[model samples]
Target: MYKYDQYDQALVDARVDEFRDQVARRLAGEITEDQFKPLRLMNGLYLQLHAYMLRVAIPYGTLSSPQLRMLAHISRKYDRDYAHFTTRQNIQYNWIKLEQAPDLMADLASVEMHAIQTSGNCIRNISSDQFAGAAADEVADPRPYAELLRQWSSFHPEFSFLPRKFKIAVTASDTDRAAIQLHDIGLQLVRKDGQLGFRVLVGGGMGRTPMIGHWVREFIPVSQYLTYCEAILRVYNRYGRRDNIYKARIKILVHELGAEEFTRQVEAEFAAMSDLGLDAPQAEVDRIAAQFADPEYDAGAPDTLDRSDPDFAVWVDQNVHAHKHAGYAIATISLKPPRGIPGDASSAQMDLIADLAERYSFGELRVTHSQNLVLAHVRKADLYALWQALAEADLATPNLDLVTDIIACPGLDYCTLANARSIPVAQKIAARFESDLARQRDIGELKIKVSGCINACGHHHAGHIGILGVDRKGEESYQLSLGGSGAEDASLAKILGPGFNKAGVVDAVEKIIERYRSVRSGPDERFLDTYRRLGDAPFKEAVYG
Candidate 1:
C-alpha cells in the first residue's frame, strides 16, 4: 500500500478543518439546508430519510490493517455497529449525526483516509481490479496508474464541478473484473510490440441510460496517457448537457454526437494539448511503481491445498483464486453468509478481518466490486488456518460467483431515492437456495444483482440476472432482466416482461433458473451463456406465462 507523505497529509488535514467549520455552521442554523447541500455533499455527507449518511472512500479498494481497524472503531463509536460496503468498493455508515461527523472525519484522517469526492459531481474514487497485483493473468498491476489518476483528478479546478458525476476505472488483464466498460472513462493497459500503452474507452455508464463505452483510441502510449485523458475530460466538460440532470452524463453527449464525431473532437483536443507538456514523466511513473513492489514470499512453499477436510475443500474451491506466484493465492472473504445482508460487516467482523489480513496477507486487504473482501496475497500453505479463522468469524461462505452471492443496494431501507427494499429480497433469495449446494454449483457462475432504483448503485445492469425495484400504482413491484454481464464480455441486461410483486419476484427468479436448467446445453453452461445462446424468449415465456 502507498503511504501518505507530508503533502497528502496536509491536503487532507485542510479539508477536514474546512468541513468541521461547515458542519458547525449548518448545526448552528447559520446555514439552511438548501445552502448546506453542496457543502455537505463535497464532504461525502448525505441527508437520508432517517438520518445523515457518510460515505468513506477506499481508494482502488485497498486498505491496510490499521485502516480496517479504524473503520471498525468508527462503526462502533459513531454510527450503528455495522458498515455497508458498496459496489463502487466504498463503505457507507447509514446512521450518522451531523454534530459527530467532524469527529468521524478527524478519526479517518488520522488513518490517512477521508470522504472527499465520494458524493460530489466530481471524479469519484478511482477503482481497479481487486486482485490487481496478485492475479496470475494480469499484464501489469493497475493500481499505480489508478493512484496517479487519483492524485491528478483530486480537486482539479477544471473538473471540480462537471454537469454530472464521473467515474473512471482501470484494468490490465484480458478479463475485465473492474467493469471498465460501464465507467465514464475506462483505461485498459495493453502491450504493442513489447511497449506498454493504453486502450481508452469513453461515455459508458448505467444510471437511466445504460451503455457500453465507445472506443475512443485503440492505443495511446503510456507516456501520453495523462494528456489523452485530459483531452477527453475537457471535451465533456465543455459540451455535455447542463439543462437536464437526466441528460447530464457524458454517455448522453456521446450518444447524441455519435462515436465518430466524439472521437474526432477528442483527437483535436489531444493534438492541441500534446505539446503543452501534460504528459507524465517517466521518473514519476517509476516512483509510483516502486511503491507497489511485491511482498517477500517463502521460496519453497507448497502450491496445492490439503483436501483432507471436505469443508476446507469446499471453501478452497469457492474462495481461493490463482495467483501470479506459485506459492500464493488470492482469498476472497465472503460478506454474504447464508441469509445475512450482503456486504454488511459488523464492527467485530471488521476487526477480525484486519487481524487476518495482518497475519496472512502482509497486513493488506482489497475490497471487491462484488461487495466482498480479498486477502490478495495469501500463501497456499496457510489456507487451512486462514479458512478456520474466517469460519469462526462467519466470514467463510463457500459461494463466490454462485446465485447466493448477491449484489444489493441499500434500497428503501436506507436510500430515500429507492422505491422498494433490496436487502430483504436478497436475503430471501439466498435462503431459498441455501441448502442446495450441488444445485448451485450446477447452476455455475451466476451473478444476481438487485437495485432499488435506476441509479444502478447495485450494478444490476451488469448482472446475469438483474432485478430493479419500481413503484407501480402505489405497490412495490420488481422488474427482472437477463443476459447482463460485467466481465470482458460486458453487456446490459434486457427486460423480461411485466413486473412481479414482492412475493412473486422470488418465484419468478426460480422459474427463470429452472428454465435455464432445462434449456442449457450442459451443466457447465452458465445462466448468462444459456440466455445469450437462446435469447430472452424462453426465459420471458417462463416468467410471464
Candidate 2:
C-alpha cells in the first residue's frame, strides 16, 4: 500500500479545514442549499432521500489495516452500524449528520483518506483490478500507474469541472477485472516487444447510453500515457456538450464526432503537449512503483490444501483464486450473504476483516470492483483458519461469481433518483437462487447487476443478466437485458423485451435461467456464452410464454 507523503498529508488536511468551514456555513444559514450544493458535492457529501450520504475514496481499492479499522470506527461512531461497498470499489455511509461531517472528515484524514473527487465533475477515484498484485496472469501490477493517474487528476486546475463526471480504470491482465472498457478512459498495461505501455481506450461509459470504449491508440509508451491522457481530456473539454446534461458525457461527444475525428483531435493535442513535460519524471515513477513491490514470502511455505472437510473444500474451490506466489492464494470475502444486502458490512465485520487482513495478508486488503473484499496474499496453509473465522460471521458464502453474488445498487430504498426499489428485488432474486448451491454453481458465472434507475451506478449494462427499475404509469416496473459483459470482450447488454413487475421480473429471471440450462451445450458453458450463442430469442420466448 502507498503511504501519504508530506505533500499528500498537507493537501488532505487543508481540504478538511476548507470543508469544515463550508459545512459550518451551511448549518449556520450563511449559505442556502443551492449555494452549498456544489460545495458539499466537492467534498463527497450527498443529500439523500432520508439523510446525507458520504462516500470515502479508497484509491485503486487499496487499504491498510489501520484504514480498515478507521472505516469500522466511522460506521460505529458517526453513521449507521454498517456501510455499503459500492461497485466503484469505495464504501458509503447512508445516514450522516451534517453537523458531524467535518469531524468524520478529520477522522478520515488521520488515515490518509478523504472523500475528495468522489462525487463531482472531476475525475473520480482511480480504480484498478482488485487482484492486481496477486493475479497470476497479469503482465505487471497496475496500481503504480493507477496511483500516478490519481495524483495527476486530483484537483487538477484544468479539469476541476468537466461537462460531466468522468471515471478511469487500469488493468494489467488479459482478463478485464476492473471493467476498464466501460470507463471514460481505460488503460490496459501491456508488454509490447519487452517494453511496457498501455492499450488505451477512450470515451466509454454507461448510463442512459451505454458504450464500450473505442481503441484510441494501439500502444502508448508508459512514459507518455500522462501526456496522451491530458490530450484526450482536452479534446473532450473543448467540444463536449454543455447545454444538456444528458448529452454532456465524453461518450456522447465521441459518438457524435465519430472515432476518427476524435482520434485526429487527440493526436493533435498530444503532439502539441509533447514539449510541455506533462508526464511524470522517471524518478517519481520509480518512487511510486517501489511502494508496490512484492511482499517477502516464506521460501519453504507449503503449497497444498487438506480437503478433510467437504464444506471447507467447497468454499476454497469457489472463493480462493491462484495467486502469483506459489504458496499463497487470493481469497474473496463475499458481502452477499443468503438473501442479505449485497454489499453491506457491519462495523463488527469490518473490524474482524481488518484483524484478519493483518494476521493473514501482511496488513493489506483490496476491495473488489464487484463489491467484495480480497485478502490478496493469504498463505495456502492458513486457508482453513481464515475460512472458519469468516464462516462463523456469515462472511464465507462460497459464491464468488455465481448467481447468489449479485451486484446491485441501492435503488429507491436510498437513492432519491430511483423510480423503483432495487434492494428488495436484489434480495428476492438472490434468495430465489441462493438455496441451491448446486444450481448456482451449475448456472456458472452469471453476473446479475441491477440499477434503481438508468444512472448505472450499479453497472447494470455490464452484467450477464441486467435489470433496470423504471416507473411505469406510477407503478414500479423492471426491465431486463441480457448478454452484457464488462470484460476484455466488452459489450453493452441489449433489452430482451417488455418490462415486468417486481414479482414478474424475479420469475422471469428464473424462467430465463431454466431456458439457458435447456439450451446450453454443457454445464461448463456459461450463461454469457449461451446467450451469445443463441441470442435473445430463446430467453425472450421463455419469459413471455
Candidate 3:
C-alpha cells in the first residue's frame, strides 16, 4: 500500500515519455525490429507468439484497488478480456498491440503503476512476502525495505546491464512464503537484542541450474544494509560471467568463486564502499517506511464475526490467514477452481477483486507468488460476508497450499519458447485431485509446479512434485521431479528418469503419490517429509520401473 511520491511519479512519467517516443519510432519504421528489441524489453514490452505482451510491475506484489481497477480496465478496453498473473506476482496482457503499448504505460502511470524493470536482465520486480505486513509471526514488515531496494535499484546506472537478470526478495516471517531461498539475493528481516537487521542469503536461483541460496551474512544492521547490498552487486557486476547467458546469474558466479572467496570479495568491496558512506540515506528509508504505517484501528469492543454460514466457515478455515493487526485477517482469493485456469482472472473477476479490495480489505490487494490473488487486511468480523461475495464471483475456492492449487506458466499456448501447454496440464491435475478435503488433508503438504520448458518460469524445480514439459520427437512430453520444496526447507527437485508422454504424466504423478502413501510412517507425514525420509529411490522406482 505504498503510495507514489513526487519523485516516484516523475520517474514513471519520464519512462512513459521515453517509451512513447521509442514506440512511435518503431511504428514509423524509423527503427528496425533488431534495433528496437532492447528498448522495448527495457520498458517491459514483449513480442510474443501472436501479439505483444506487456508486463506491469506490481512492486512487491502489492496493489491498491484503484490500481487493480485500472488493470481491469486496460485488459477489457485495450486487449483481451483477461490477464495472467505470473509466478513473480506481476501481471501480463498477452494481446496488446505494439502501437498501444505506450498508451497503456501512460494509463498505468495514471494509477501509479508501470512496467519498468518487469522485463530485461536488470533487477526485476523486488518481491517480498505477499503476507508481509499482515502475517502474525512477522518480526517486521519487509515491504519498507523491499520498497527501499526497489527505489535504489530502479535505474542504478551500473546495474542496468548486469551479466544476467538479478532477483532480490525479502521476507520477515518465519515461514518463507516469498521463496527467498530461490532468489539471487534473499534477505530475511531479523531483530536481535534491540537492533533490527537482515540475515542475507546469496547465490540462489532457478533456471537450467537451480540452487538454494547460501547464508552470507548472519546479521547486517539496517544502517549498513544497502551498503552491503551494493558490495554484493558490485562484485557480481565485475566478475559474473557474460560470455554465456546461462552462466551469467549471480548464482553461477557464487558457485564458480567459492562462497568463502565470494564473501571475502564482497567484504573487501563493502569496506571500500563504507569509507565513501554510500548506504541508502536514512531519510529515504524513513520516508518510505512512513508511507506503510499500520492503519488505525478502533480498539473497540469485539465485533461479531459470524461463521454460521457453512460455506463461509469452510472458506475461513481454508482461505483466511492470521494478521499482525488485531481483529484483522488476510484473505486469499483462490484462483484454482475445479476446472479453472490456475491464475487467469477474467476482466469481470478482476473488477470484482478490485471492488472487494476497496470495500472489504483496506483498499489494498496483493498478488501472491503462488499465482493467487489476496485481499490483505480484511476485518475478521466481515470474513463471512466477504467469503459470500468472493464465492459468487468464483474466487472463493478454498484450496490454499494444496495439491490442486498448482503453479503453472503460459506454455506452448502463448509462449513462443514453450514445448507444450502448461495451463491444460495444470487444469487436468486440479481436476484429477478435485479436493476431497479429507483426502487432500490426508495427503498433506504437496506443492506441484509445472513449467513449459527448462526455463523454469513456473519454478518447477521448487515443487514437491515438479513437472517439466519438453518436446520429444515432435510430441509433447513431461519430465517429473520429486522432493522439491519452496519453503524454509527449500531444495531443488530430483528428476524421475525418462520423460513421459502427456497422458502418462498424470498417471506418473499418481504413482509417485501412491508410493509416498505406501511408505509414509503415518497419515501425519506429508509427501515432502516422507520423500526426504525415504529419498527418491522409492518414487523413482515406482515411476520408472
Which candidate, 1 or 3, has the higher lDDT?
1
Per-residue lDDT of model 3, residues 264-313, tens digit only: 99999998888777666878788889988887654662544677777677
Score candidate 3 by lDDT.
Answer: 0.88
Candidate whose lDDT is highest: 2
Whole-model lDDT per candidate: 0.92, 0.94, 0.88
TM-score, per-candidate, Cα-based = 0.99, 0.99, 0.97
Whichever of 1 and 3 has more TM-score, that candidate is: 1
TM-score for predicted model 2 compared with the true structure = 0.99
Considering lDDT, which of the candidate structures 1 and 2 is the better prediction for this target?
Answer: 2
Worst 10-residue stretch by lDDT in candidate 2?
293-302
Superpose all Cα atoms of candidate 2 onto the true structure and report the RMSD in Å to 1 decimal: 0.8
Query: Which segments of model 3 are wrong by more than 4 Å?
Result: 301-305
Best-to-worst TM-score order: 2, 1, 3
